[model samples]
Every structure is written in structure tokens, then in C-alpha cells.
Target: MKNVETNKKIIQKKQVKIYYLSPEYVYYPIYNNNPKFFVKSKSNVFKETLLFEDNNTKNYSNISGQVMGMKNISGKNYLVLKNDFHEKYSAPKSFRRKVNKLTKKEILDILNENDAASYSSDIKYFINNFESIDSLILNLLICEDSDKIYSEVFNKYNSDILEMFDAISQIFEISNPVIMLSDTDDKNIEFVTNLSGMYPDIRIVLSHDKYPASHPLLITRKLNLSNALVLSSMDLYYLYSIVKRNKKVSEKMILISGDALNSDFIVETKLNVLISDIISLCKIKLTEDDVLCKNSAIRAEVVSIDDTIDTTVDAIIIAKKGNNNPKECINCGLCNKNCPQKINPQMYKLNNLPFPGKCINCNMCSYVCPRMIRKDI
Candidate 1:
């Protein structure tokens, strides 16, 4: 009778359910350690699982004072770093110095003194051939759904999209400013139309029929524009704050999503915060075998929870481990047919041709593969 009772307890433990939430889908329990069986469409559970209230306001640290110098490379100007910007500005003593003490000439001189090989082009461009930019391209397709997390964050921050457009125009002396959106779904297209209607001076272009349509090179090719500057929505927001409000790039907007999360929401936090810290704040629980992916599942790399978050990270995804025991390739030729860049993935592996330099690493071939081979190999 004791053995029978022990068996019953073991069965109960095996049946324990684990719920996970993502921006677009949800899943429950672990069956054979596979997420395929549990995947389902997102539902009203998102409202209850919201980690942050709609009206909650967060104060972010500012670091515009550390704008060491600007480097113009290949028609784009990048903000050079100075004096451990992310760290020093996030520290307690950062507020003691109310204003940035460095002048434009002083910042340039510092850039010259550093004189690293990597800094050569930028320093030389800024010194010799500095010209006012002509155009700015605002990329709004970074989020999976523009109407969901991104628009919510934009409205919550009380940022005016038109105001941002004007600010960037004036700062860069840009005459042709364009807002590019990827037409992945009907809702995204509708949102882009409504936004474009509000701003007459800004041009809106929709990219269709590509996996990574929002990629900078792809956007430049699709739009047929040259010498144009590209900036993400987050980048424009920070730039507006910097030029108008004297703010800095101290805070970052992060999208927390994936099947392993209990709830998925967008959170604004200080730069350099540890990934573990953000997970704790959201009250996320992870099992020993579950995996955490930085950015998108298709393009980003898997990282440990202990890693420190970088400024460029836009998304954090938690997912079950992928199936390593893939079946043999059936050679249905679907990988070649569906490849957006038209590279023969199968033939590339066989060394029938040189390396596919045009491959964008979008993972579409692997996604469409019947045998689950890694095309990126």
C-alpha cells in the first residue's frame, strides 16, 4: 500500500502545470519538454498578467552631458563615447554635476588625443568634411506589432510623434524626413496610415513581402534613397529629449516576451542593469532547463540570465530548448524556393558555390525546412 501511494504522488508531481505568456501567444505545462503541443493564441489573460499599470510613471537617468564627440562615417553620424558614459552617469554622483562642462572643441580634442585606429574615420570626417545631413529615416518596424507595446510606450511617455519629427529635422537640417513601416499585418498598416495622416511633411513608405524589411540596408534599397540617416523610434525619442530637454541616453526600452514568461510587457529601465535584475522585477520564474534569448528568437543569440543588459537590446525572449535531434533532410527544395535573398542553402553547405555574401541571416530557410537543418551553418 505504501508503494502504491508513492507511485500516485510521483504521477501528480509529473502532471504539475507551468504557464507561460508571450506578446502574441501563450502556453501551459510541459509535455515531453516540447512547446509545440502547448502553443496557443494570446487572450485576455494578458490584462491580468500585466506587470506594470497603464499610468505608472518611471524616471530615467540622463547622460547628455557626456556627448564626447560626433563621428560622421559613410553619411551617418555616430555619437562617440567618453569617460565610461553608461557607468558614470548611472552612479549617485552623476547628479552633482548639473550641466555638461565639456565644450565642442574640448570634445573634439579628446577624440583626437584618443587617436585609436577605430576612431580614425570618424575623427577625420568630423574634422575635415562635416556637412549638415539632408534626410532622416525613422524606422518604426522594430517591434513585432507597432500598435501594441511600442505605441503604448510612446503614448505613456507623452511624446508627440510630430514634435519628434520636427526636432530631428531642425537639428540635422534635414529637408526630406521619412518614416518607414513594415506592412506585416493589417493592423500595422492601419496604424501607419493614421500616423502619416497626422504628419504631412513626413513621408511614409511601407515595405512588403520580406522577412527583414526593416533592416537598414534593405530599407535603403527599397526606398532608393542615398545619404539618408536611419534611426529607430527609440533613437528619435532619445534624440528629441537630448536636443530639446537636455537629456541623455541613460534609459532603454525593453520588450519582455516569450513562452517562458508568466507575463510579457514593455519596461523602461536604466542602462547596464543586469538581466537577472529585470527578471526579478517582473517576477518571472524559470525552470532549470528553460532558455533565455536576447532580442528576437530568429535573429538574436541565447544568453544566460546572469548577463548584463546592453543598450542595443530591444527584446528578451524565454523559450524552451530547441530540438537538437533533428530528422534527416528530405531535400524537398523548399529552402531554396522560400529564401528571400535567393541563396541555395542546401547547395551552399555542399560547397557548390562561394559563400552567400548577400544572405541577411534571417533564418527563413531553417524555418521553412522540413528536416530542421540550420541554414546559417
Candidate 2:
């Protein structure tokens, strides 16, 4: 029995890849020579200390599996653990106290401190306006990369999504919390169903459609559901931190991806950190023609280096700017077909058709266009 327990500990302590990013520090696994070696941030930590004995032999099948936690202190990056080998690095006593003794006012104060007061107001508004809500839908779908980061963190922490739901329900005295998954893939559905099975009150709804299915407006329209308070997985995670962990919304998990990037990364960093700082840490070199877009590649708005990181900025895409030359549309109908909202791009462009407010701005119309016309024009 002792041997089995010891083996379990060994398996749990197995070294995994960790990528720590902060304004002052960055540590990401480099796979060319050795998968375990990580480039240090601005810290003076020795390279020898970052590598593990089994890193050479251990295959890093999934980089997300390796990320344990991310921390930032006094604008400086501290130690990055390759594995959660010890609980000494656990939550601080103050944090534990906050989690244990959470109140509505305390949670609200934390949200306000983190620039998330709008969320508190929204919850209050909902509670005040509605006597009973049909369901509280937690949207698990963001863009592909953002969804991956959300799932990984949720799984890594073994977080109970229902805990957030319970807290909200208790506060409002509302019942029926549902998780809405926009992906219909067998694997994704199975995973969501399994996680939701542990909570009897929580149910799963599979939308399983193309792009824009995750959009709140579209979800509500398609699901024929009303009086539903829709929340993103990130939002719920923040709620969990407030109610259960007594943690502030200090950092956010974001995906940095694009053709111009040396490599894609799922990074967590301090809130309101400068985009320039993150780019520097990622070692991304931007050319004159490179463009940076926040959130989804399809729907997100273009941002600049001057912008600071925010909760809504899920993914940062650094890609080469498209051709500036605009050509007349050929009326291929490709744009209309690809559009998840079924809006006629050619009509909107040529005929000056009234703008459809339903447009989710999923740049698919621009992507499918042969003439490279700007859809926003």
C-alpha cells in the first residue's frame, strides 16, 4: 500500500513544461536542442535550475499540460516551477482567508478593484430585474485557441464550474445553471458531459454549429431561450476566484498566434500590462507590415502596441497585413455562404444595403472574398 502511494506521488510530481510570462520575466520551453531548457525572463535565475533531470527523456506531448501556475510580484517575475511538486507554493494565508470568508460585498469590492465592477453591476441588474431566470448559461466557447486555454486551466485546477454557479444562484436564489458548449465534436462533448456529471443541478447544452455559434446573440436566437444570463468561461473562472479562492483578477490567460509569430503561445500575464511588454517577452519581432488583432482572428478588432492587456482580450494575433489594393467584387456569393449570420456582403458593399445589426463581425466575409475588399468599409 505504501509503495502504491509512493508511485502515485512520483506520477503526480512528474516534470511538465511551464511557460511563465510577466512584464519582468518570461520562461518558455525551447524544443530545438532540449525540450526542457527555458529562456529566463529578466531574472538572474541560473539556466541549470530551470531544467529537470527527466526533461531530456520526457516527451512534451502537450505544452498546455505542463503549465502549472503563473505569478507576478512588484512588476518582477519570480520563480517558475516546472511542476506542482510542493504545496509550500500554495495560496497565501490571506488568499485562503478571503476564499473561506467570502461575502457578496467582499466579492464586489474585489471585482471593483480589478476593473471588473461592470460584471458586478450586471449581476446586480439581473438579480433586480428578473424574478426567475430559465437558466444561467456559461459559454465555454471562445475562439479555438482561447477555448483551449480556458479548458486547460479549468482542467488543471480541477475547478468546479458549478461552484461559481452555486454562488450566483445562492446570491440571487435562482435555480438551474446550464453549461453551453458550442462545439459538437465527440471529444469536446464527452469531456464537457463528464465534467458536468459531478453536479446534479448543472446541465449541458450542445449547440454544435459553425463560427459565430458561440456568440451570445446567436446562441439566444438559436436556442430559443430567453431570460438567460450568459457568462463566458473566463467570467465564471473569475467568479470562482472571488467566491472560493478570494483571489483578485490580476492576470489573464491569452493565446498569441499568427503566421508572423515564431511560435504560438498560451500565456498568462498581469492585467493591464502593456502589449509591448508581452511581445518582448514572447520574443516576437514585428515588421512594418505586421498587424496585431485582439481576440479572434476573424471577429476581433485590430489593436496596437500601445494598448494595455484587458480581460476581454483573449488572443493576440500577429499576422502580415493583407494587400491594400481593393478590387471590385465579382459577386461570387462566397462571402454570403461563409457568413455565419447569413448577411450578403456583396449587397452590403455595392448596394449600400442597410447594415444588419446581427452581424457578429466575424471577418469570414473578408476572408472568403476573392477581391480582398474590406468588409468594414
Model 1, 205-309: lDDT tens per residue? 766534456666677777888766666655545433443333344455676676444456577765545566677677778777567766655554787675544
Instruction: Choose the strongest candidate by TM-score.
Output: 2
TM accuracy, model 1: 0.59
Candidate 2 Cα outliers beyond 4 Å, as residue runs: 1-115, 118-133, 182-191, 245-247, 260-262
Error of 2 at 358 (Å): 3.5
lDDT of 2 at 53: 22
How large is the C-alpha RMSD of every model relative to the true structure?
A: 17.2, 14.5
Pairs of residues clashing in candidate 2: 26-41
- Please provide, for model 2 over 1-377, each residue's C-alpha lDDT reduced to its tens digit, 9 standing for 90 to 100: 00011011101111222244334422322224333434333323321132322334221111111333335444432223332223121225345443324565665666544334333444444434546566677776533433545554555443455566656655555576767765544555676677665566777777654555667667777667787777766667666665554444546677777654545676776554567777877777788888887765555478877566655676787766767566887877777887777778778866666568977776677765667665766
